[model samples]
Target: LAQEGQFRQRSSSCHCVPTSLSMAVRGLKAVALAACALAVAGKVQLRHSSHKAADSSLHVGSFVTPLESKHQLRVCNAFANSAAMDVFRGAESLTAETPMPYKSCRDFDAPLKSGDKLEFRLGDASSGTFSVADLPNNDAVLLLVIHRHDSVSGAVSFESHVFAALESAQVAVIDTY
Candidate 1:
């Protein structure tokens, strides 16, 4: 009778652990679902900092257009308030009237030269303006868009940074067995 009681107690305790684990898993699923719903509804806001790339060296396989050569502009949309962005060069829209989505990047086919002006628009509102002269004298240029949202006043602001890299020397190809 004593051995039977001990076996029953151990079995019951083992069953209780599984029950607790199931409840914990269910709770986690519920939280994940709630977060997904918020993102789908566009209620979630993203905040990012505009910082230059840590490694400035151009990789061996990567190519960089010389400063004297034609240049292309790469824009990264980090703005979270709106779903998409519109890029304008003066009165012309570079994105062909389609807004670039948030957290996505676009490369403009048109070349950017010094003294050129670029306007960043979110929906119908203009977020910020950037000048080509703001970029460094490096071979390639990347435009990073950073934004700040004011919850109190319901306002949004944007800032852009230029990350450029210089052309590195070509690595000599050596045939090895």
Candidate 2:
């Protein structure tokens, strides 16, 4: 009887270890699955936020005329609230009828004036050389012309006008690659 009872105890002890090991493996698998789900959700959220930001920024590549879009920005110094340009681009002057693409770095409470010579250029999407020239007939705005002379295979020139800066001027950047 004593021998038989010892044999039974040993058999039960061996069974208990495998059952414990199986439970441990099941718990580890559950944790790994949970971690994977969290990672995938995070990636999806990141992509969603990026797309949202892109929608708001202006795309300089999409518009043939920069002034035609709502994203047109101009930077300049201002007076009583009316724009008074000192440094005009693509055009020597501005008018209510002629819409120019630009943004001002100064206070928006005043008007935009481009009196200062502001360093300006089209963003990287430009493919051609843009020249700022004078038109004899129109003194109100400078004539900005894009020439294909230095254009690579698929590039076009775009221009922005700066107007109101007592000392300096700047354009607002919408996006970067």
Candidate 3:
């Protein structure tokens, strides 16, 4: 308790403390929280009043059920050669903004709405731009796999495979030639 008080006092009043890294980390956390809040707000707005009323019946401590109405996108990095892979969502780099990539696998997942075009980059190796409307409506989840391919012409390429369950659908194989 005494050590905790000292830490609080020093952090609150000490001007000589070098806390730039910690401050930056805190700022990034704030940004991420704000983004999450905005997403929740958007979902709330889209939901009907009947849904809201139905939600009130559930116990307070119970887990909220996830809505599967929106199309789900899962980007997987199956490329074994690269030490690490970076993923980008639009102009913002998803891997760069999130701290989870450093501790876990380099992958991204998001809810994509119909007619919304999602563009992403897989480091410098591969990139793709596709709309939710383009994907088959039969599958709820769209899997985008980043993989390596060695051509007979002594060329290395990154191919993206869209998978529905165990079946592979070759939608786009972008050549970085």
Candidate 4:
């Protein structure tokens, strides 16, 4: 036969080229495990909708007492709200704080009066909106609203030690992220 049918058609096309490269490496590992299980179920549904919108926008007499020297504070980021606002001021005025580890706190519908001039919309869409006015009608502001599944290096190492201990007690740190 003509050279044994060309050696059985070149050994069945070299065994279908390693079985088509092992089915394209198992279809690229099943599309990378279904895109890592849909990115861990969209970060667990954005951490349960940012803990139910930070327990209904933190209201326990909306405490505010932390100002030692951020040069009499004023931070801005007022309007394209996805989540990420960390404005802390502390040098001495603290009546009883420490209860905000991150849970969507920026989409103010209305009702945060005290020379209200807050508007920060920056979660990450090429960040844009920002407006913060002179907020120091007797200092004591600590608004730390960060979302997107927080834990960004433990909220930037606890806001970089609360912005270097409120800039070494110069206290006016208006950070709008």
TM-score of 1: 0.45
lDDT digits (tens) for residues 10-124 of candidate 3: 1223333247855886899899879877776666555533365647553222234443444355555544443455655456566676422222334355545555544434356
Q: Each candidate's lDDT (Cα)? A: 0.53, 0.32, 0.44, 0.32
- The candidate that achieves the highest lDDT relative to the unseen native structure: 1
Can you rank all candidates by TM-score, best first? 1, 3, 2, 4
Mind giving the per-residue lDDT tens digits that candidate 2 earns over 4-92? Answer: 00001112223323566668869998997798667766665665566655475532222222232111222332111132223233344
Report clash pairs, candidate 3: none
Better of 1 and 4 by lDDT: 1
Off by over 4 Å in 3: 1-68, 97-109, 113-133, 151-177
Which of candidates 2 and 3 is the stronger one according to TM-score? 3
Model 4: what TM-score?
A: 0.17
Alpha-carbon lDDT of model 1: 0.53
Taking the tens digit of each residue's C-alpha lDDT, what string does model 1 give over 103-162?
777887666665666777776777766655544443544444434345454334444333
Off by over 4 Å in 1: 1-67, 136-138, 149-177
Q: TM-scores of all models?
A: 0.45, 0.21, 0.34, 0.17
List clash counts for every candidate, in order: 0, 34, 0, 19
* Ten contiguous residues minimizing lDDT sum, candidate 3: 1-10
Q: Candidate 4's residue-wise lDDT over 124-172, tens digit each?
A: 2222211232233322333322222232422221121012222123332
Among all windows of 10 consecutive residues in model 2, the one with the lowest summed lDDT is: 1-10
**Candidate 4 — number of clashing residue pairs?**
19
